[model samples]
Every structure is written in C-alpha cells, then in structure tokens.
Target: MEKCSGTTKATSKKRNASSTEASLPDCKKLKSKDGGKTSSNKVQNKEKTKMEKVSSKKKHKFLGSTEVSQSSKHASKKKIQDGWLEVTKNDKGQLLFKDFPQFQPNMSPKEVLQAGSFGGTYFRPIYSSVTKQHCEDEWKELPEDWLKGLNVPTQVASSTYRDRVNTYKVKCGGSLEMWESSGWIVTQDPYGWFQWYCRFYQGRRTKDDERQIGRWAKCAGVKGRWRNNLITKVVRSGCGFDNPTVSPVVRQTLQHWGYRLTKEDYKEGAKRVKPK
Candidate 1:
C-alpha cells in the first residue's frame, strides 16, 4: 500500500510538469504575434509621415510660383505708372513758359510780302506770320532794321524763295496775273498750300486751323522726306516753331534759315530789337 501511494504521487508530479510546458509554449507564441503586429504598425506610420512631408513640400513650391508671378505683374504696373506720371509732369510744366516774351504771333500778309523782298531777307517774319497766330499777344514787336542786318533779300523771286506767294494768291483770291508779276511760281497746288498753312500754324493757332493747314501741306507734298526735313530744321534751330504746326512755305523758309542761321545770332537780335 505504501509503494502504490508513492507511485501515484510521482505520476501526478509528471502530469503537472507537462501542463507547465504546454502553457509556456502558448505564451511565447502570443508574444511573438504581438511584436510582429507592433513592428508592422511602426513601418506604416513611417511611410505615412514621409508621404505627408512630400505633399507639404509640393504645396509650398506651387505657392512660391504664384507669389513670384504676382510680384512681377505688380512691378510692371508700377513702371508704366511712373512713365505716365513723367509725361504728365512735363506737359504741365510747359504751361509756365507760355508767357515768355520771346513768343510771337503768326506774321501778317503784309509781313509775309515784305519778307519776300530782296532787302527783307529775314524769313522769321514770314514764318512767324504763317505758323503762329495765337501767341501774338506775347510777342515783343521787332524793329525794321532787324532784317537789313541779317543780309536777307527783301524780294525773293527764284524757286528757292522761302515765301509761298503764289500759294497765298490762289487761296486769298488774288489774281493769277498778280502772282506772275510778283515773280512767284506755282509749284504747289492750292489744296497743298492750304494743308501746309494749316500745319505750319498748328499749336500756335486753333486746332481747326492746324488741321486745315496740315491738309493743305499734305496736298503740296505728302511725302515723309519733306515732312522730316521740315521737322529737323525746326528742332535744330530751337526756333520755338513747332514743325508740325506750319505751312510748307514756312517750313521751307525755316529749313533755309537753319542752314545759315545760328541760335546765338538770333538771340542777339532778339535782345537788341523787338518784333514789329
């Protein structure tokens, strides 16, 4: 009976050891599964973070391009505004010089006639008369001797004559005989002369007058070369004569004068004498 009891106790201890071994294997398998799941989650989280960073960088790049485009547009607008302002300022400032004493009105028909004479060589009278009419009030009258000193002919009868006497005759209702007797040639048609007259007096006269004269000058010689030469002479002389505002006759006269005349010499004349 004692042997049997000892054997039974040994069998029970073996069974208990077997049960512990089985439970230890189950615990180790559960731990391994949990570790694997955690590692997979960590990898997913890392990938998600990298994708988010890439998306954020792309957004920043796109936004930077938009900002740069807007800035460039704003700068361009600013430059245009500045240029406009400069033009406005220059125009406004020119008004102050309107009252300058050197300003003169367009010359009269009688002055135009005298300017064509052999003894009356200075063509300013003829040019001023035909081109500028509005500024008459501002001009200081000149003396008679001013022309004599310049060595200009009192009567110009050749093709090179600066005065468009024949033109004036046709437009002003003078007889053709009068033009012939005056030694004037009919180079420009009446319409051409009228256009020239209108342009020669543009800014100094009314816009209506300017248009009228421009049409006439166009009739006489609408070519660009003639127009450009007229403009060049006016600019170089600094004669205060706006080339765009005068008749062809006046333009021709100014061109001739520019070839021989100097601004300094004219200024001296202005100082010494007043326009009659």
Candidate 2:
C-alpha cells in the first residue's frame, strides 16, 4: 500500500476494484520553510557513482514489456524533428520554460510511464488553474496505447498513488506537504518532478532544466547517492538486480526518475563501487 503524509493520507487505504470515487483534498494545499535552488534533498547528499568493483553479475528484469502498438500510424506522427528546439506553451496555454540542457536525459518520458513508475499516479491530472485541466492534450501526442489503464483526472488526494499500478506493487513517497515544505514544488510543473521531466523529454526546454537534471543526476547519475547505496548495500546484499525485495522503495523511486534499474546498471555500478 502507498504511504504518504498530508493530502495523500486518505489514499493510504487499499482500494478495491469496485471502489467508488472517494473525496480528495485540494492539490494546492501544502507547506514550506526554507527556500532553495534545488528541487529536493535527493540532490543535496553526496551519493555515489556507477559500479566499479563487483563483476559478472546476472541480468535483472525490473521493467514490464512494451509491445509494439497496433496504432502504428498515430505513433509515427509524433516524431520529433532534428535541429528543431523551441518550447512554446503547454496544453493549458501557459508559457512554458525557456532554456536548454547541456546534455540529454538518459531515458524517455513515455518509457518511464510504460514501465510503471509513480504507481501510475505521476500523470494523473490535478486541477489546472488556467484551463481547469492541465496538459491533457499532450497525452494525445503520445502513442495512444501507452496512455492506457491510468486513472485520469485522478482524485487530487487519496487516489493519486495506486500501488497496484506500480510495477513493484509497493508504495514509497512523501506527501505533497513534505515536498512543498522542502521547496520542491514548482508552479510550472504543478504535479512536481515527473511532470517537469515529461515536458523536458518532449523538448520543452526551460530554465529549470539544469536544476531538475542536476537533481536527477544526484539521484541516479554516476555520483548519485541513491545509486551508491544501491550498489553498496542493496546489490552487495546478494539480492541481485532482479530482486525487487532487495530495496523495493529505492527501486520504485528510481523508476519514477526515468531509470529502469537493470542487471547491466548493477554491473556498471558494481564496477565503480568495488573496493580496492
């Protein structure tokens, strides 16, 4: 079951298939104290790098299979053009961010969504102050099949984090209150990090790109603190890469960040982490 504080508290209870829509809190309700440049504390820690020590580890299956879509025509039309980079407004007509990344992200937004990250709650539409619906049209640009089976216009509170939708069937996250208090919430990406990531992946460059990418790097990059722990503690425990039981929480969290943890990732991390 998913466990988070604040608006998510009511959602902690396990939901049945026949369950009716429950009351949800306002998505805008939140808190904070100190302000900072980075999105979350995940970037503040001195994490770690790709594996450098362990060797000959086995492959792990952390992601579900994504079969080719029958609606090939729609998928083909969404092709992004080369040498074309201009971020306009989102579906809501809000002026999008204007900036560029020094580098590209390692993964794609659709891949993360299909792989089952954020408990299928990441893209759930929260109330949009502008058009009363945020970025709903953007989903149209994606493969119609990829957006299947998600809770659209998700109840702002309790229903936002459905554990069953997650690949690991476990819940791991802080509440909107926790994120707001940490100064992680940005108005541009009202739903938070993944929303920003989705736009970024679509080439919606923004000033926030550098900071967001920095946070991602600190979370999964070579020097990522989370990656370090995964290599030193979880992987070293002999649970192997495929063992979700090894660090289910961390694994799920990484999935949200566009990183599908694989045995190869474990191998590279092991190479970087092995002792002298």
- Which one wins on TM-score? 2
- TM-score: model 2 vs. ground truth: 0.54
Tens digits of per-residue lDDT, candidate 2, 208-244, equal: 7677878887987667777667676654687766677
The TM-score values for the models, in the order shown, are: 0.18, 0.54
Off by over 4 Å in 2: 1-106, 125-145, 149-160, 272-276
Model 1 segments beyond 4 Å from truth?
1-148, 151-208, 212-276
What lDDT does the true structure give each of the candidates? 0.34, 0.54
RMSD of 1: 33.2
Compared with the true structure, what per-residue lDDT tens digits does model 1 show for residues 215-265? 333422222234444444455555554433434444444332211123433
Q: Each candidate: RMSD to true structure?
A: 33.2, 27.4
